[model samples]
Structure formats: C-alpha cells, structure tokens
Target: MPTVLVIEDEPGMAAYLKTELQFEDYSVLLAYDGLEGLQVYEDNAQVDVILLDWMLPKMDGLGVLRRIRQTDDVPIIMMTARDYVSDKVAGLDYGADDYITKPFKMEELLARIRVVLRRGHERATYQVNDIQLDTKAHSAVKNGTFIQLSQREYTLLLTLIKNVNQVVSRDELLDQVWGTDYTGGTNILDVYIRHLREKIDDDDSDVIQTVRGIGYTMRTAGNDN
Candidate 1:
C-alpha cells in the first residue's frame, strides 16, 4: 500500500483526511506541524507522497518543501486555505508537485494524488527513438552516447520525450519543467530547447522541432505519420 504523510494542523481536518485516505487503502501518516512533518518524512522511507498544509505552528509549508527538495524528490501536494494564485505559485515554485486549496472535495484530492503518483512512476525512466532518460540516475543517453544534462535541461528533455510526437504547448512545458510559479518568460524555454538540441542532436538529424507559434515536438525523422 502507498503511504501518504498528512502534515495538517487542524485536528478535525487531519482526522477527516486520514479517515478518507485510509478508506481508499492508503497507509496514512499524520503530523500536526511542519517540524513534526519533516521529522516523520525523514524517518519514513515508505512515504509515497505528502499532503502538506501552508499554515502551521512551527515551520511553514514552504520551509518544509525547501528542506525536502534539498535531498528528496518525493511528490508533495500543498493543501491549504490560501486560495490565491500567488500562494499556489509559491508552493509550486518551492518544488511542490501539486497544490490544492482547502474546502476542496475529497474526491478531487484523491484524483490529484493518483495523478501525481502515476506521473512519478512514468518518469522513472523514459525512452524515445535512440534517446533515453533515466530519471533515477539523473542521466540521459542518445545512440549509446551518454549526454550530461543540467537539472533544467534534463527536466525539459523528459517533458518533451514523454509527450513525443505531440505538440506540447509552451505553458504545459513550462509548468512541467520549471513549475507553475515560474517567473521566467517563455524565452527561457526556447533557450533550454536549444541547449538540449545541442547536446542530443547530430548534424544530419534534429529530434526536437519547433511547431511554429504553437510549441515544440520530439519525433523521429520521417515518422510524421
């Protein structure tokens, strides 16, 4: 069974989430404050995902997020009463995989958790044509040649290859690669695309293609079918 760490402070809300999640067959871990949450996460290796609250007694959600991102990439969903766009962006920018506002339906929270877990599994390692990405190793290879990638480059490549043959919109790519709260302009995406092309593409062939004003696509040559 997948384990979920619920770092919510409110007794009622925490109990409610724990009950619902347990009913869905998930093993739930509970912590009432950010400090306790971090300690629990550090001690538990089986935690598959984290449901964190923004407002807490000791440390805030963003602090916990930063600390976790320093060493682990476990998926995290920020569940808070702060519903503003800025708040959501702040959570995402801090490395949260997803964000949910309070007063949300339990069903929606369950769906989001499922989606995050699925994405984490899918990103373990992905391949397209001769290019391969092992997210576990944080490495990429093309045609048997190892290619070193910076963190952002690797994320961009992963996103493109995951959606290979499809025109991934700029916004989608940005959200997946740079997080939804990314303040950088779209040109940053173009720059990273160029960096990836240089590292992965050969003289006679290009795997990454710009779709005019739409976005970008990764596909094998002559396979436009």
Candidate 2:
C-alpha cells in the first residue's frame, strides 16, 4: 500500500486531507505541526509523499523540507496560501517537488499527487503472463486486447497480480479492496471475482483459481499453482 504523510496545522484541512486520501485507498499519516511532522516522517520509513502547509508551529515547512533533503529524496508537496511566484520558486529551489496554493480543489491536489508519484517511482506497468496493467494510466489489457475494468476490478486485479502465485486470503482482499470497515459478507468478494473472470479469464479455464479454504490465487497457463 502507498502511504501519504500530511503535515498541516489547520485542524479542518488536516482532517479533510486524511479522509480524502484514505478514501482513495492510500495509507495516510497526519501531523498538525512541523516538529510533529518531522517526528512522524522519521518514525515512518515508507512515506511516499508529503503534503505540508507553509506556516506551521515549532518550525516552518521549508525548514522541514531542508531537513528531509539532507538525507532522503522523497517527494514533498507544499499546500499553502503562499501564491507569490517568488515563494514557489524558493520552495522548489529548496527541494520541494511540487507546490499547490491554498484553497485548492481536492481533485487538482489528487492529480498533482499522482504526477509526482509517477515521476518519483518506477514504471507503472505490471505484466503477469497474459494480463498487463498500466497503473499510472489506470488501464489494463489481456494479450494486447484492452479489457474494460471498473475501479474495484482494477484494484482487485492489481492486488492479485502483485501477489502472483501466492494465495490471498478472503480477509486480506476484503481489507485491501473493500476497506477494513466493510460490513458486507464474503459473497461480495465472490461476486467481484466472477466479474473479473468474465473479463480476463481464458475460454478453457479460469485464470484465478480458488484456494479451497485458504482464499484465491491467480495462476497463468502451465504454472498450475
């Protein structure tokens, strides 16, 4: 799972960011002040991106950026009210990867997050046997034939493909795809698995096989695992 560390001192904005990022299936860590933010970053070794406010207590965002740049190259995005061109230039020169002004639309922020992610990370494509996915574009294909997939279907396929030959338990799928607080029954998972099968399975056999009592596994041709 990808993680986002949000450092905004404003109670309202920080809560909003945490909620929206979590809704998008991202693991989110929140810090209300610059010092706390630095502590949070140091505690979590796998922070993918940071959304930081310009003015913060204990220390400023640029200070935090400089501190982090001394060792790590992780992407940092400034989300603040400093819209002056000089301010943006200074932030970028000081090692902030991206800058977004305050009162920003959530969609724009999300898109910016994705763009930085694509640049900071490796290629987004994942290929397993016949199935292939370009995660950056949110597109998937089977043997070069485009296969239409819903958001849920794409996530489900990506999870299984990442695990490849291993069994993904029912609890795991439910937690990752449907969120941890899902109140629905396991039948929902079966339903989506059927939907995926219809789109990607070969005519002769199922690409994703049941693991009997354990969970489910995706096995391509010849492997038989």
The model with the greatest TM-score is 1
lDDT of 1: 0.85
Clash pairs of candidate 1? none
What TM-score fits each model? 0.55, 0.54
Clashing pairs in 2: none
Question: In candidate 1, where is summed lDDT lowest over 10 consecutive residues?
Answer: 121-130
lDDT of 1 by residue, 27-63 (tens): 9999999889977975675689999999998888998
lDDT tens per residue, model 2, 69-130: 54456788998786889879888999899999989999999999999888884446778888
For candidate 2, the lDDT comes to 0.84
